[model samples]
Target: MKKNLFVFLLFSCFLTHSQTIRKYSNEFMNIGVDAAAMGMSNAAVANTNDVNACYWNPAGLIGLEDSQAALMHASYFANIAQYDYVAFAKPIDDESAWGMSLIRFGVDDILNTTQLIDANGTIDYNRISKFSTADYGMTFSYARKLKLPGFQYGVNTKVIRRIIGNFASSWGFGFDVGFQFEKNDWHFGLMLRDITTTYNVWNINEDEFNSIKGAVAGQNQDLPQSTEITLPKAQLGLSKKFEFHNETSLLASGNLNMQFSKTNDIFATDVVSIDPALGFEYGYTDLVFLRAGVGNFQTVTQIDNSKKIGFQPNIGLGFKYRGIQVDYALTDLGNQSAALYSNIFSLKVDLSIFR
Candidate 1:
């Protein structure tokens, strides 16, 4: 019993440190959506031109030839977590576009061991229960072309919802803006996520609080702060396509992501950190595509106390026919990066197909 008590004390101490809102809040939204983008290590911001653009860069929606819908599903951490996405977009008068998207990331069927030991010190298997923790994001997007040729801009109003069974829940709202420009055969894009500094107001269930309040050292332990903040971030990208032969083409893109703090990123400074990514797609007759990318550079300390650079490489395949598209990407292949390897798949359909 002494050993268990010691472990509990350590765990409580860790919890106390993380009780308040801090960096990386609402991070599930950053996991990203759309297999095509992830396949290219999320470097498609400048060239995304479908329903999926609603999540990547809504400005790209102006390039959609028809109304579109997309669906994606991915399992991570050996199936312990599930990520799902859906989106729809429609162009208006060939001058603007509107869209909506939903994303859900969750871990289900988790055993609630907190109640396993009763007040009488009686342990019963039947006392164990199951619950799930999930995060959801819904976004409404609109885009319009400017008077300047090849210039388009977009905006997003998004809502974030997070739940931890009956323990805690939060709701947040945020705004994002994106822009796309084409000049002299070059495509440039900018995406500002959480531009307004997203905030989540949390509500803790005191009834659930009673269960673990005693785990800490004192009964005077206070409830955690109820407000969480997500800092703003941005991505800048450039892309271009080259055509060769009768039915062969290649698309190359690169992105630089910026954050406000110093970190392990390859290019980190006191005021900001920048992570760069590169992606390429080779298309055959516009029907099949092969994609590749590399990104997420960081300095890692080896077991031997040596520092070295580490990066993630991603590859993907795509096929499209009759206004339908299927894309597949294996991010973090072979655990080369900190993230677990997962197979991502997404499907896109032209709503006109039903006509």
Candidate 2:
């Protein structure tokens, strides 16, 4: 009982400290495809079936009773696409489990351009360049149902890499740690990700070098330099769920994704932003499921009274066949005024190898 109290207090502290800082960074890599399919409302972290759970909340692997694997693909705005997630988890005894996962994001067919001056002011045309830019990561995870009453814990270690044409590539490492508790029909969860202070170390080449250097060539400039960018601020999230019946549940989850740096400033001060989400799911014999969710992050951050930051909605559906599961989701991105508004369509395949 005393240990349980300590754990609760620790979680409370995490929430308090988490609230004090707010910022979002490298948000592109942080967006989880599976979560997006569910309207990004995954605070309770109940994704034990899909391999993408390795990216969502590794602790969720505790719910897997058999070896399972899955794959997910998505197309973002500007013809950029991503392929993510394959994982296998096997139970060891009844209390412990281990898993491995691979996540890859590929953006192909990007047009490369060079400036040409031929009477018509400055014209830009296709120059010699490669087909895509990509980022990939590998993760190893371990999860256990703790003996401590009402508590479960899990952790993951990841190696991350980014490749931007042949001119730039970066590598980094990070980890995620999480805890969850359940009693009766109520569930609560907490997770902290990117705790290693991961940063992308860029290796820039000559063409890229000359572009920056030429712009400021008149001034004394460093011939060549290496720079690093921190991925995203470490984040802590809290979620809760209440099941009204065997087949129906209502979920309310929220996250404070802090951004320690901003795009304009390489070393900007930290800022805190709040993202709250609500979702509902209905199940029929655990075979067919319908879900809808809505969330917004920019609502609280926008300074202009006329400028709306976040005002989007999300909806999805799922089906189960034998032991295989498939899911789809749609997320709204306000309007064209938002610049690069996105409509994400994702497919996930979950297969259980052993039951």
Candidate 3:
């Protein structure tokens, strides 16, 4: 029971005591939003279709053609941490569509050294104080268009909020499902994020957790019951598009994602594990874009033990007019930072172009 503050967002979480499942729960919603799908590295689950697909593959939000809105922001490490996103989508007459999204990852002020020691251990540096640690996600989406022709489907409903300022807080719920299919031109997708497992329910502040209790020594500090579990994951995608006569075009995508247990990826085993990704985009007449991607394929273990095969690469740029769209990403999430602006940018709007 020694977490009385000064946690720097606990390196973005992943600490629990019981309540099963979990493997990276929530993970900032897998850190992919716009920026042309993290410059493609996320492989867009069959190449997304706008308004950030409510967070990728909400059946591509039926590929939105009109009402839409989006925004994004990013920063990490050097800036301490902050990420934000927003979205909106619409279309309901021709088969269906709807969307909403919001996300925020944070770390602010920090430093709350548990009253800096006192009651006989005197060291009070003015009893430092100031804190924040946040994570929030809200989503709602729906999509339809399936009478079997080119198929489509989508769903999501998620709400999670976490905080660590007063010492602890949590609330969660989740669901996701998606599917897409296209024929000749080729594209296929599927996603299943929390499918049904997510749960968080935590609340602790026992007097701010008794200011770190015994601070260790007898080592029996109890008072943990975090209860967080999130499991169920999958993604499979494929994409294709190529044309090269007058305006040029190219699109290629791939993904395997998945998670169930064993992992060092590279297709590991034990139950399920796979991680593969690739993405690309290049267009011209549709109004300029270029992108690239590669994905995380960890397997490191060096120093002389040898075993390498790490990956993650991305690049992106996009622009469109008449309906306005802008995107950019140099990519880095999990690897944390490369500094300088911390990259990633996004914006999309086509709210009927203001009617």
Q: Pick the candidate with the highest lDDT.
A: 1
Give the least accurate 10-residue stretch of model 1, judged by summed lDDT: 9-18
Model 1, C-alpha of 249: deviation from truth (Å): 0.8
The window of 10 residues in a row where model 2 has the poorest summed lDDT is: 13-22
Evaluated at residue 191, the lDDT of candidate 1 is 95
**Cα error, candidate 1, residue 320 (Å):** 0.3
lDDT per residue (tens digit) for residues 1-355 in model 1: 4324633543343243234656577878888888888888999889888898899898998998889999999998889999999999999868999999999998888666666667787887687777777899999999999999999999999999887777777889999999999998799999999999888888877787667565444653577677877889999999999999889998999999888888888898989999899999999998999999988888778999998888889999999999999999999866777777889999999989999
Cα deviation of 56, candidate 1, in Å: 0.9
What RMSD does each model have against the real structure? 2.8, 11.9, 18.5
lDDT (0 to 1) per candidate: 0.85, 0.55, 0.80
How does model 2 score by TM-score? 0.73
Per-residue lDDT value at 274 in model 3: 93
Predicted structure with the largest TM-score when compared to the true one: 1
Better of 1 and 3 by TM-score: 1
Q: Once model 3 is optimally superposed onto the true structure by TM-score, how far is the C-alpha of residue 150 displaced, in angstroms?
A: 0.7
Please give, for residues 1-355, the per-residue lDDT of candidate 3 as tens digits.
1233343224234254223456876677887778887888888888688778888888888888778889988887777888989999888767889899999988889776656776798877788778778888999999898899998889999999988788678888988999989999999999999888889788777776555555433542556667878888899999998999988899999899989899787788899999898988898997889988888776777799988777777788898998988988887544522223358888998988788
Determine the C-alpha RMSD for candidate 3 after optimal superposition of all C-alphas: 18.5
Candidate 2 deviant stretches above 4 angstroms:
1-25, 35-37, 44-50, 115-127, 211-225, 229-271, 300-309, 333-355
